[model samples]
Target: MLVPTAAGTPAAPAGSPADTAPSVSASTAVAQARSTEVEEQLARDPGRFRVLTGDRPTGALHLGHLLATLDNRVRLQDAGVDVVLVVADYQVITDRDDAGDLPAVVREVVLDYLAAGIDPARSTVFTHSAVPALNQLLLPFLSLVSVAELERNPTVKAEAVDAERRQGRGMSGLLFTYPVHQAADILFCRANLVPVGQDQLPHLETTRTVARRFNQRYAPTTGYFPEPEALLTPSLTVLGDDGAKMSKSRGNALELRASEDETVRFFRRARTDSERHITYEPERRPEVANLLRIGAHLAGTTPGELADAVGAAGAGRLKTVVTEAVVEGLRPLRERRAALAADGPAVVRDVLARGNARANEIADRTLADVRELMGTMYS
Candidate 1:
């Protein structure tokens, strides 16, 4: 039994609609107020700050991705943030045994970005492999951090263990040192802010450490790289149907581009307990709670509110409601995706090419400055 917060709210059990409603209203109001504050903050001088965020091109974007980070990116862009969205094609091979259909996967990722409301004209969207300077910066960045330091990164260790468990083998050297490469990705663009979830704080800290060390060693008078800060999102942890963290390989993800039938089938098959009543007791009933969270996110309300609205409705009714809300919420995105897909790959290629050119120009200037700082700019 998870204890409630300072608000004296307990977990809504099977027959406690009265206790749940006020808590729901209070939580929803707080969340709304905080969101408004963030929006107000972003609206002021977003153009002065450079923000970099991205995803590994392992597959298309999913509902979890949208709730966790993509939505924040869109908001930032709309508020005039200088946004650079990276499709990390190179990182796909870091832990995986195989890079599956790299080109097709990358293109699909871009389409998903476009569908998710990332305007290419507003936000620079480029593939990691297309930016040569990013790779070039990695050599020097790697030298700044030690093997022990790399091995100690919690994100790298967790990812390596998961990969080895899946593949039944050990990870490669590249997988172990991937965080250093990530540092290069951030510093190369001189991005001042990186939007990330709480679980990714360790990686962002590593990036900050690398930036600080590089500046102190090379250019103490004036810092060459900005010590990028993590813009931690409030709703970062989105669980999958199995009550575990949402991931593509788990086969529990709700893909953003999933068909109407597929979406229905996915939610219909969601795992809930034998107890019929829908309640918001995550610690005790995670599967059903996960569905409630998804539904609340889609319906623009709190999970407690959603549960109260359903009253004593059983799991079947809850599932139906969640499925409808998800389908309806994703309708516009799906329509946009279909229209973009119909335009074929040429349009996506053009967007990527233009973004790549812009990224290259900025990266080149940064690299030139780094070389000059290190006294390696002979020509």
Candidate 2:
């Protein structure tokens, strides 16, 4: 049996209808409606929504994180939504065998979060391993999905290829089922809103599928899980100094934790066209526009305005403006981060402890509900 959910997708039985695999255009239209609805609801009653979003601790966060999602995470939290930030430590090994500097990287991630204004009091910041019950939800979630559906996920396919390339071996089973793990993360808290970029819509779709199927099969009347809606990020993609997506591994990223001198050095080596006339034409002049966008973000103005302000000054003057903006804008965060770093791991440990405690509480309750619904509450 199948029923249409509020999101306009049919809640067919798992693997049935092949999900009817709506065409890209159809799915995008549905997603657009949901996004609009979510925004409207947020404007009226933001507190009613819970947001789940995070990053892996595989690398330090960079400018892209700031412009894309971290800033918005703070905005949503301040707007009274319950924000749950997960440091996906377990996922670090999905591709690589050893993240040898796990402790250091996790600490760095926490530091970045704190520095980025993710108040530990307002948000729950937890790691994956600390809450075993969360991962336990995976088994049931996995059952609600299928191998073919997992294979069909474009994000999974891309990551799997990248993983194999990095490891020089076939993708791991964990990598194949990564979207399901992400589903567990979302539904564990029953988060109804997830902030994501365009490329991540497919992963969010998988979460919605598992949530819908689980409710239909296990708790039809109750609708135990929310079909999470994507709060599509409005920020433009922050490109690298080299005109591509900012990436730390590629050495094109300007990390949030970088020293002022480092920031200057990065822009110093940045690529820009020879045109002395400055303008914010991302499509035609991506290199120059990348710098302008970054500057505009820091200066609290539009890229075009920044460009006009620097009109005829050329790339040299533009880089200097951006460099100064970055340094001055990041000053307070750097100070806060330095203070946090000085306390050793005390602050990080405390944040994780509180966050993990709350996560376990929520996860246990959700797990119990699932067991009761499935008639598996043996205890």
Candidate 3:
């Protein structure tokens, strides 16, 4: 769902059916209502700190991924979190069948970050392929870590089972070894904070374990790895037109690149129950529940307020309110994307160049420490 935060931005799709306008019970029907005020407030706060978060460019970022990597990124950046967008191009090859597309995919992800308003100046963004030292850390760390330990990691098991279901076999070594590499990604830069949804806590825990293990093995007295901490996101956003947890493989995801018409069409067709009365019972009314959730999120009002307005309203009335909220929510984002896309592909390249250099700089420090400790050739 588009979260409209820009002012004077057109929210309702121009082609939206006339009847889909917000009803009296619903507020903020501006379709393109400005809501960045909240983020602006957070940005002005002095206490907000830095963050390192990103994605592996396995596919185009759908709405689900955007909320994590882009929307939350914009909010945190505004909240003064020093953000680093990581393009895990190397991780895409974890299970193979995608080695050739990594470069373009990296550029594509970088563009998405830029389009999403991640200011390169406020945040440093980098690609995994560019940081050879970071990747090298994975090898030695893997030796310190054991196969049995890897198997126990939650993300590993989840992906392994998922891969097995889809490919009729378990995911490969890269997929299996991904958790350790992730540990390196966080620890190499000495990142102290990662923003993560609740379900992703386990993934971040692995980073914590690795930091503890490495510090115990090498710097037990002084401590290294920083034992990165989690911001522990309060809520999660769902995707897929079906209102299920959005995923690329599910074919239910809406891409950031989707057009206004596409966005409208996508939401209009989203799965909702046949029971006409629009209510905000998440457990009871998943379809209407999804719409209510989107509306509440965008309107900055509690879901209870939405349910009150929607009380006894049939599906048609509920659709009008939800559609309006969604349209208003996305309009500013569309404008921002249009402006950023005009900057052209070269912009992404420069961000990558600068980010990669910064990453190498950090990775070099860790690599140096480890080499000296192990009495390597360079040391």
Candidate 4:
């Protein structure tokens, strides 16, 4: 039986239709009402709904990252929502053997964000290591959660397995407890909304659980943290040239900063079946379908329409079409990135510095409140 969050009449056993009907109906009504309430709250003042989203900054941002998150972040910023983009620099060490010039990597990631239209004036972009309050929040959050609970997080488990395979070693204790750190990331900013894909629902649920537990234990009557709601976005699983998930480590990803010539060359070499005619059958022709999906995403059209447009054409023609669309679409972004690069590291540093100062101010207030509640504040 699914446990309820609030005190309510217990759900009847499955056999009794007469008793179960009202309970089911009431449960549905309550769920709908709560959803409506959240919607109203968001609609009333979009700016009041603080959104926290970020990347690990392990590598340069790629096209997959753009569609998966950066685009949505730009939309949210334009809609006047307070956006906090965390550069999760600390997480880069979780599975890797070497940090590898992290400062340079972080700078490149910031430039990619600016190139992809993330306006620094509108969104706060700060590094995770810049904020000391996060550490304080993380310690208490760790106590609230358990070893078993951390071990049970599906995301962490899957990542650990993958890390083990790559590193040929067991996961570190820090990697095991990364979810608790993520919870602190969200709650420290008091973020009310987090944009995530479906697969990330488990991570968000962990964050919600941490928030709820803290509020209940420390400030039962007046909640200190808002249990963040997941703002589900359309999943964009852009495959690499080899028909696997696009990843920097695999060297199959099309970086956001790829030059026009590089974009053309990469897609030209993308694997496609020996079919004489073009078609959109992802199950059987994933490589060709991957090209089609990339074109659709770039051209703002459906894969079916693209298939019809390229009907009876060979894979070479399809590649040509896809490459042109991708290159043309990315031209403006490339120009912007080039301009930002010409300005040097000073601009990126300034943007991050301002963001860090502002974020620290907000985080300090929240940490102060938390300390007062926990009786750690003595003046």
Best by TM-score: 2
TM-score for each prediction?
0.86, 0.93, 0.81, 0.87
How high is the lDDT of residue 312 in model 3?
84
lDDT of 1 by residue, 32-119 (tens): 4544554455565566667888999988889999887887888888888989988988989877678989999888889998999999
lDDT of each: 0.78, 0.86, 0.69, 0.81
Angstrom error at residue 12, model 2:
7.3
Q: What does candidate 3's lDDT look like per residue over 1-379, in tens digits?
A: 2221121222232234421323332312221121233234344652344467788787767666654556777877776776777888878777767476676776667776776778888788998888999999988778766787788777788886788678456688888988888888877877766766555665666676666566655664555556555655545567468777778768887777778687778777788887866667777776777667766766778777887898787777776777777667767766776776688778778888888898899899888987775668551
- Badly placed stretches (over 4 Å) of model 1 are 1-41, 159-169
Question: How do the candidates rank by lDDT, highest first?
Answer: 2, 4, 1, 3
Candidate 4 C-alpha error for residue 195, in Å: 1.0
238 Cα displacement, candidate 4 (Å): 1.2
Candidate with better lDDT, 2 vs 4: 2
Once fitted onto the true fold, the runs of candidate 4 whose alpha carbons sit more than 4 angstroms away are 1-45, 159-168
The numbered model that scores best in lDDT is: 2
Q: lDDT tens digits, residues 1-379, model 4? A: 2111221223223244522223334634443454456556656667667889999988999989987888889878888888999999999888777999999999999999999888889899999999999767888898877787787787677876786677458787778999888998888888878887656766766776776766666776656777677676766788887778999999889999988888888887788888878888888888888889889878889887898899887888889989988988888888999999999999899999999998899889989988998889999
What would the C-alpha RMSD of candidate 2 be, to one decimal place?
Answer: 3.2
